[model samples]
Target: MAAPAPTAIRLHRQRRVLELTWADGRRHEFSCEYLRVFSPSAELRGHGLPEPMLVGGKRDVGIARIEPVGRYAVRLVFDDGHDSGLYSWDVFDELARDEARNWTRYLERLAEVDMSRDRDVVKLAALVGQYKPPQKPGG
Candidate 1:
């Protein structure tokens, strides 16, 4: 069966959610963070997945724009300058349908590696080898 086409798509900036209404009378709301972490771009999914890269520090990322892709998908431009993922209708539907499960898995993966959605945490981890703790004034 053919996938239902999107009848309407709206990005609510204040709420940071992508609201999609389909021809089949289904509506799905996707958070910007969710979309960013699950982007279909090669950078995120990797060329062949030896386990795609774990993305962190996207807690406040926002969709800068959503451009149509040949009536089949959308290219979401993120505020952080990522714009490679092409979210097709089918993929969008799958994301909406499997949101709960997928999000749980993502959290689990993050936990497994001690990573977080906080950018500061990622930066601190990257500086582990170079950062020096500040000395006390009288030490």
Candidate 2:
């Protein structure tokens, strides 16, 4: 069965959070940075790689607008001009369910590559000795 849509969608711009409340009395507050990084857009999700690309440097993003698409999804327009993702109810549910794990994983991935949540800030270690070139296929 498909996931149920949020009964109430509230954007707390001041706090930079997207809150969703469902019929089952479940509520989740997602950070704008979280939603932006985990966006269901092809630019992020459609990367043809086995895993989705890691997105960093969006710690302060806010939702500019939310446009409903039919009964199943909403398109999130970010203040940073990213408006490609269609966030379906299922997507929201999955995000809420896995928020903790996902956030941890995201942070770990960023650290692995010496990436930063702050824009344009690369770790000095990455610039010095931690930089490793991508491996060739099957090498």
Candidate 3:
């Protein structure tokens, strides 16, 4: 059976959600962070390896834009400068269908690596252009 085409696609930046409606009347809402971490790009998926790269510090990432790729996929440009993933119709369907399980697995992997979905503190400091060392008292 052919994959159902998206009848509508909406990116809600305020809510950081991608809303998609399929030709078969199914609707799915995907978080921007979820889509970023699960990007189909080789940078994340790594040549069909058993273990894909773990992406972190994207808790507040948003979709900057979505550009059509041919007639079957979209190139999602993220706020963090990731623009390589091509989200195809079949890929979107699969993501929507497996969101729950995939999310759980992702969270588990994060825990195993002592990582959090929150932005990395070091990166945040760099972005802010300052790193103040902790003060030492009683010199």
> Model 2, 1-139: lDDT tens per residue?
8999889999999999999998999889999999999998889887576655788899999999999999999999999999999999999988888989999999998887878899535677668786689899998
lDDT of each: 0.86, 0.90, 0.87
TM-score of each: 0.82, 0.86, 0.83
Better of 1 and 3 by TM-score: 3
Error of 3 at 18 (Å): 0.3
For residues 28-139, write the lDDT of model 3, one tens digit per residue.
Answer: 9999999999998999998867755888778899999999998889999999999999999988988888999988998898766567799433345344666567788975
Off by over 4 Å in 3: 120-139
Count clashing residue pairs per candidate.
0, 0, 0
Residues 68-106 of candidate 1: C-alpha lDDT, one tens digit per residue? 998789999999999999999888977888889889988
Candidate 1 versus the native: TM-score? 0.82
Error of 1 at 119 (Å): 2.3
Model 3 pairs whose backbones collide: none
Q: Pick the candidate with the highest lDDT.
A: 2
